[model samples]
Target: MSLVSTLIIADDHPLFRSALRTVVAQLLPGVQIVEADSPDALNLAVQEHPRADLILLDLRMPGVQGFSALITLRGQYPAIPVVVVSAVEEPAVMRRALDFGACGFIPKSAGLDTIGEALRSVLEGGVWLPPGVTENAAAEEQEERELAQRISSLTPQQFRVLMMLADGRLNKQIGGDLNVSEATIKAHVTAILRKLGLYRRTQAAVLAQRLLRAESASLAELGSAAEGGAEEEAE
Candidate 1:
């Protein structure tokens, strides 16, 4: 296959973006690099450059709710390769990223060489991950994977409705935001619940909350690791 030409780095941190840009320049010389600090910007970038070779997405960026943006990006642009680059290094989080359709997951703490290898592997149409991670699923992880599959089955519009529901938006409010009728929003809600095998809207909200908690925990762990690493370097 051809080499990657245009790459998008979607992260809110300027330092991280700069670091990644340096690595990309070193590994993939002469490639065009785009920067997006939020999900909205990322969407716009994709719309403007539909043929971008790769997108490195951060999970905790603004204008995105946990993995919702990743799911939406995969749904909308299945042709583009997206590799999640984040500080969250939890195996469960990594598994969820792959389940949500990321081609690779690169921890922020990884060395530049590892990041380069990941980008090269992804460009060569191979999935990349840290050592010791496997596709094998535990029983509970399998259930979560099934749930993620169901969630991935949602249409883009239905996914938006589900996200609004998780945000506690009323049908009328959601309809106003989507410029559709309350009846239409209600229909989407019904479909979302049915597809997710959920009984009540509250259950969907609870599921969303669980995902948020996992992301938050991962971020917390990442912060602690960063701090510990800095202390170790100082000593």
Candidate 2:
């Protein structure tokens, strides 16, 4: 008997999601597709379907800060392959996605045939990048890679605490948000700092800021593309 695959399509735009769904259905008949309009919804879908074979994620979806969602998913769901599908097609962005553990990077503008091929490659345990893109390890990229490794080591709870800290949330506020006590939040903070090899919480916040800033321009482009897509759908 043939195995059936489940793919999670996590993009904010309904038009794009439908288009991807159609492509997946046509390319991989009998595949199950779960659609998520936001990062939170993606998480819920993954939880509900833990055996999902792959996730196609959008970097700028609601509740995601740059590549944080990708990082979180990679850390939390290491068994499931994640292929980033985003409007940001810069080589640098693609490199970052691979460094953060994405099995493939498919630009939103890619042809359906290319998308299908990329998805198939990832499903076959191979990494896929756009043609002509070579992996280069510059000094800055090496630094980012080290940081990503450290971040990936965090437990899911610790990761959540660290993100809250990066957002400048007080320990009390974080505790309230997670429904835990301030003391527990403090311990999680200490653990986060230790894991990231940072002495101060401020350093963690700075690192998060740097990562988000690196993708800011691409995120702006993604927003514009989403808006344009919406307008085209309406016309």
Candidate 3:
């Protein structure tokens, strides 16, 4: 609706990111484009560019667990809209992405014209879905939604700690990586466990793992390991 000025492209694949960037430039010439290749980088990009008009996100990016990153971004920055540009073209996945707060779902298989059309529509405050992917008004499971809400409540730093914990990082190591005292990381871990209604760090790790499994059965083969080695190592 407003003048499009800035957008964040959050995808791990450089070729796909370049394709999206080209389409975006054509759709809105002179628009500032910021690229983030991982979940942590996306978080930092959002922090650095809070007024971005939209975010183009890839669900399977390293350190991202299904819709966890989307949910967290929507929760933290409700004003900014996100569009899922992913290779996983399952209709169920597209619908679930919309249910989780993405304004649109554009399959990576889409032609450049279709991708531009989808981006244009969403940028103008419209919802977009690929052909044959109709919106399902059916609600998600109550338990799943509740968990999403809890995860969405996390502050960004807490989320980083949670993901690092999922990677089996200890408090001291997390502190060193985050550049703070071990006690601060311990506090963050405590806050994360309490907010997620868990009792221990392992539970938080398991919760992070569960978020990876949030997709439909068709995406069972897409494991966190697929993108893990490609990301900047926390170790």
Candidate 4:
């Protein structure tokens, strides 16, 4: 089995970016790397690419564009952690990047071993800071998990409606598919949004997929374990 995680590398310096890719490949073979030349390409990749598990960033990528890119990308896809790998090692600059949602910061001069360790750590639900950073990525993850739990309390009807939303089914279509009235589906959707702390149905839909997929994975693991146990007992 392979870990299906994605990585986007956005930097203006081609040589450095290529080196970074090699480093990542050597470290995290499970990660699929995508390269973006300009900030625009990076931004587009962030939106168009589905399932970006991590991002390796170069902060000094011409015009100081990477910082703003990091901010916008984090704002849109907070689940994807960005690791800043830049030559700038100023304490203030490092702290600012972490403040703006960078999960880790590694100086460009850092050795291959350190970079690999940094990316690996962040992918495994941990954050890396060279020395000092005010914000903690683990705390944010805990908060997100707490919010997910609160949202998971949706009523059965709301949960079903959210599942439909995850399937990209519209309200009326979901109602028809589930043999419920459209108005009732609408009510359920509203309840789901309220519980998920989302103002948009699309946001609720994304959250629905995350939760459902996690549940599916757990069930799969249990089934596999049971089969394995049965096989051993028969020996």
Candidate 5:
């Protein structure tokens, strides 16, 4: 019998989710698969299946940006292994995912055989990356990693509040959305700022925005690098 009984799929694309489900079902027969299409659903799925064998995550999900979701999952469920299955197939992104605690990084463009190999490798307690990607490849900037660690220290509620703060929502507005008191929201904001080493809410917002922008910039940089490599290959 397979050791993995429960697996969670956290991607927004339904077709891709189905493809992953099929591959997993074939690889580990009888394994229970849970699908979460949004960040909230992913959180609830994790809360529900804390002992799940593995989680396949997409970086760009609704209500989460950059590595925030990965950080939260690692913070709250350290035992469960997470493998990022993202459309962004940059080596830098893969390394950043590993730095943020992913057990593996599988590009969405990978073939079924490659995906199966990655899954089997991770399931057997080994880390997996695309060919040519090193285990100790260059990671994200030190400051970004420090920010990620600080963000990881936040409780799930505090992280939600941080996201709302990034949207420039007032405390009262955030409280209304979260169904909490304004005072409670204020306390969360205070704690978030403290944990993040910031004095004002505006600073937290700017930092959060910076983290979100970093993903876009990273993708652009990856595109440029890939172009350069292609030109070199054609030379």
Candidate 6:
């Protein structure tokens, strides 16, 4: 039998998923393309799509598992390669996805050729990153250096609070958004700033943004919650 690129595409957007279907149809031809409208659907489909060569996952889907389903699935199916296909193009997320076992990261902005090329590279057992990764090597090193210097002592909640600060949400707003009291947000921010040895919130915000972005792609791979949340709030 001819090799078929059996794929399971999981995303919350009907339009995006449909577009993906079209792309697969046009490019892979005889390949088998399965669809899952949400993270839960993807979880169910994973069992069905056994021997599936590829799983194109959307980052920031929803729920806690949203951060880690890929790693879990990979552990279960070591032979299958999972490609993080997301609109989140932040460099932080890109590196995290790779760190969490994603074979490739295909930003939504990528063209058909780019997507196809990545798919081919993954199938060939190579890490499929854009040329810019090497092109941006110097900046990449600088970022890692800065991160190592800055985030060496933050607690988990302090880290999360710092990221909300980066998102430009105030203590009250962050508290409300995260379901914590403003006092707690304040405390966390104080802790984060102290740990990072930063004098201003702006510095902390910038650093947090970098850290969040770095965690972006892999954030999706971290669990199944994000995808589940995507389903619950599907538009």
For TM-score, the strongest prediction is 1
Better of 1 and 2 by TM-score: 1
- Order of quality (TM-score): 1, 2, 5, 3, 6, 4
Query: Which pairs of residues clash in candidate 1, taking residues 3 or more apart in a chain or in different chains?
Result: none
- Candidate 3's residue-wise lDDT over 117-150, tens digit each? 8987898889999877676633544444455556
TM-score of 2: 0.84
lDDT for 223 (candidate 5): 15
- What lDDT does each candidate get? 0.79, 0.77, 0.78, 0.65, 0.79, 0.65
lDDT head-to-head 3 vs 4, winner: 3
- For model 3 the local lDDT of residue 151 reads 70
Better of 1 and 5 by TM-score: 1
Instruction: List TM-scores for all candidates, in order.
Output: 0.87, 0.84, 0.69, 0.53, 0.76, 0.56
lDDT of 1: 0.79
Model 5 agreement with the true structure over 1-235: per-residue lDDT tens digits: 2399999999999999999999999999999999999999998999999999999999888776887788778878989999999888777678778877899999999999999999999999999999998866554455554555566678888887877777889988999999999988888877776666666566676666655642544321211121122212110
Question: Which candidate do you rate higher for TM-score, 4 or 6?
Answer: 6
Model 1 sits at a Cα RMSD from the real structure of 11.3
| Candidate 5 root-mean-square deviation in Å | 10.3
Q: Using TM-score as the measure, name the better of candidate 2 and candidate 6.
A: 2
Clashes of 1: 0
Instruction: Kindly give the stretch of ten consecutive residues in candidate 4 with the minimal lDDT sum.
Output: 218-227
TM-score for candidate 3, residues paired by index: 0.69
Output candidate 4 Cα RMSD.
15.0
Q: What global local distance difference test value does model 4 have? A: 0.65
